[model samples]
Target: MSPRKSVADTRRTRERIIDRSVAIASVDGLEGLTIGRLATDLGMSKAGVLGHFGTKEALQLAALDGASAIFMRLVWEPAADAAPGLTRLTAVLEAWNRYLETERGAFPGGCLFTTAAVEFDARTGAVRDAVARLYRFWRRRLVAELRIAVARGELPATADPEQLAYELIGAYLALNQAIQLERDSAAPDRTRRAVARLLAAG
Candidate 1:
């Protein structure tokens, strides 16, 4: 039998593999990911990769989770620190753009959820459900922030938080896709301007 690795060593190795997987999957699409490629990139055996994730789908899910965590840290958390009003909403949009521009290699192609949703939208099962849940969660958070802005007098009292949230998310999603495909750094700046206009309108 092979000698066992210490827990810390095992964790570090697993994290390294997952990080590489995220980078590869972002550019190649989750369907293009292979254990062999991951093992080759990490200079580890295919068995080691399999031992960590057990299967490709499992690895994909783990990569999704990792991407989500990174997004929350770089995108969500920073925006959250602003005052809970139009300022906060604008901060969120700016933070998202900053994350995309600065964290280039954080995800190889772009947002993991965005990529996976396109791939799994028509499919039914756990993965699809997970993606759907994430979308709902993000939308709710945006809407809630808009509502706070309205209550705080930053937005008109009649402003519809749900509608504004939908518009912002949709716009950002479109911009994200464009930037990823075209490798345009200005896409996010355009999105920030659009978001600012929408907030001003409200």
Candidate 2:
């Protein structure tokens, strides 16, 4: 009889599965994720993969959670020390730009959340709802920062934090597309210039 796996061993296996799922979902949309392909890629039986998640849809949701965890670690955690307000917001944006440029190992195609948005925008399902939740969480975070910036006079009193948050998030999305779609060599520079112009506006 085969030896039973330890709890730690099982947890490690789950993390490995989630890591692969996030990477694949980044390149191919969540719809592209399948148990057969994952088994083939990971050299595990389809049964072994299914043992962890119990179903394909569950695996996809796990991948979304994994991607969100990675995104926060790379983009937001690095700016934890910055003073809240414009300084923290600027640091977060810089970290975000670096995430798009340098997180190739974690996300080969681009941001998985952004990719999921395009894939599931027109669809109605648990997956679409999960994607929308991640986006809303990010927008709220930016709006909070913008509110602080306005209060600190880093931005004018007349500034609308909600609108500014919308534009800031839009800027990051454009940065992702410029890098992933256009293959623009100067994508970072252009994004920085655009962000500066946005901040300078009354």
Candidate 3:
């Protein structure tokens, strides 16, 4: 094969590895991601899997990156073009409300960031830092939108954007847990109510 063909093949193989890794890590927790398991799942040799990423940690990080892309595609990007402030924020939360339930093909185990947050929360090092960074970036996005809504009088002038962002994230996390654990059919409706109440709060 030409060098160009070889490069294309290499990229395809790496993507396959990351894709399978994200699926496995989403369900089993990042700690449960093993080279042997990936090899078996992908019909790859353990060496082949390890060759793409020098270490298991590297593979984990790659999976995290892959999952993040999926999330932006499914959740954030759809609402991205909505008018800024309350309109955009409302659009995002609505997309989020559906994402966990609807995007089973991309994420069979619910939100990868939610799983990663729990898996790495009490730990230190790169994985933990990566999880925290994603959460921080998302929180910042929510807070910025909330601030705009407040300034526009869409929300009360006394509204606290930082606190509203915190509550919004908390409610969504609870929504994920409810659907995963209880298979609660009303969880989405409950989340919507919570969002409305939180937004109307002074």
Candidate 4:
């Protein structure tokens, strides 16, 4: 018989399950994720999987949260740590590229939230609301960083932080989708160049 798990071991096991769920969602879309498939893939019993999450919706929400946590660690935190201003602005963009390339395998379909947002934008309720919140938060952070850059004289005073932020985000989103469909590494590099040009123009 298997030994009983300690508290830390249980937590670790749960995290591994969530990580697997995020990977599955990235490739399959959130709707395609299921406890049975997750259990089969992870070699855990359905009861073990269901023990971690009581329902499909619960698992979806947990996956969304897990994806968000990774995004913060890989993209947001690094950018936020840079000097507030042009340095931070560039750091943010660079962090995103790094996440796409270096952390490629983490999200099989690319950006989980990006895919989920488009999938559930009009669906409404907790899941949709959570996605919407994450999107708004990211955009606001970008704008804030750009504003700092302008204030510090790294960007032109005339630059509209909100517009620039939107453009940058739109470009990244487009590139991410293209990369997923075409399986091209150049897509992310193109995004990097576009961001650099935008920053240089500011």
Candidate 5:
């Protein structure tokens, strides 16, 4: 192949590796991602996989980025066009619930962040930092919406955006636990109700 075609194919292969790594890291933890395992799964040589990422850290980082992109597409993009207040916030939350319930292919073990949080909560390194950053980004997004809602008078002026964001995050964590641990079929419905009540009380 020409050099340009070869470069294009290499880029595509790198993306494929990242995609598979994210899927595996979701089911297993990021620590579970090894060059050997990925190569076996993808029918590539260990050297070939390592050549793409150079290090396990690089592969893990790439997986995290890939998962973040998929998450934004699945949960945030659908609600992007909604009016920027409670309506948009509600759309985003509902979109998240749908993604959790329906997008099993991308997150076979449940929320990747949730899994990573438990795995790396006590550890310190680039991986932990990346996970924390993602969490902060997600929380900030919710806080922004809550602030908009408060400013628009959809929520009480006394409402605390940070507190509201905390409750919303807890609801999602609970939903994940319910579905993954208790094998609960009603968790999503319960979460939706809880979110509705939280908004109503605002």
Candidate 6:
């Protein structure tokens, strides 16, 4: 009943809502998120859910943030300790593949960003902006390592960091489609081959 305990409880409850919202949005897309559904799923009232987020847009944005945090923890943090350049880049890419292949429990329908990018690719507003920002953040992370590889002579002097980043992105896009859309058992192997070629060329 203390003021501090009440505030802490409120924060915890808000995080709980965001956590569930992220999981739902990963499968259904952010626009499909509804306070009513979330409330029912969480056993809270619609008013309570809406009160925490204030608006549907606000809730969607919060869910995007939650998904982003989950992604960073799962994908990037695992490779964080590797040495910079090819070693770290390989670790990061391998971590990413493993995250996509094994982290289906958190994202049952594949990558959250992949789904959101398709859904919001044609839309405009804060939600779309957030999605774009996350994409840029991820690509920049990859490109930074690519640049380090170049500096270390792991890659050719003429290698294009941005182009390499694009190729790696395409590999994952194909992996997502192959696994989720085609249900291809060989998709992971295909992706690893593509990644090997992409890096092997540089």
True-structure lDDT of candidate 5: 0.93
Off-target runs (Cα >4 Å) in candidate 4 are 1-5
**Candidate 1 per-residue C-alpha lDDT over 1-202 given as tens digits, one digit per residue, 9 for 90 to 100:** 3345577788899899878877887778777789999989999999989999898888888887777788888888987778887788778888887776667687857777788889889998777887898889989989988998999898999999999999998887888777878877678778878888899898
Off by over 4 Å in 6: none
Residue 128, model 5: lDDT of: 96
lDDT of each: 0.83, 0.91, 0.91, 0.85, 0.93, 0.91
What is the alpha-carbon lDDT of model 4 when measured against the actual structure? 0.85
TM-score of each: 0.91, 0.96, 0.97, 0.91, 0.98, 0.97
lDDT of 6 by residue, 78-183 (tens): 8899999999999888888887787877788889899999999999999999999999999999999999999999999999999999999999988988888998
Q: Give the TM-score of candidate 4.
A: 0.91
Worst 10 residues of 6 by lDDT: 97-106
* Alpha-carbon runs more than 4 Å astray in model 3: none
Candidate 2 vs candidate 4, lDDT winner: 2
lDDT of 3 by residue, 34-57 (tens): 999999999999999999999989
Weakest ten-residue segment in model 5 by summed lDDT: 98-107
Query: Against the hidden true structure, what lDDT does model 1 obtain?
Result: 0.83
**For model 5, what is the alpha-carbon lDDT of residue 16?**
88
For model 4, residues 94-198, the per-residue Cα lDDT tens digits are 888878766767797789988898889989888888889889999998898889888888899999999898899898888777787787878878888898888
Give the candidate number with the greatest TM-score. Answer: 5
Which candidate number has the best lDDT? Answer: 5
Ten-residue stretch with the least lDDT total in model 4? 1-10
The deviation in Å at residue 64 for candidate 4 is 1.1
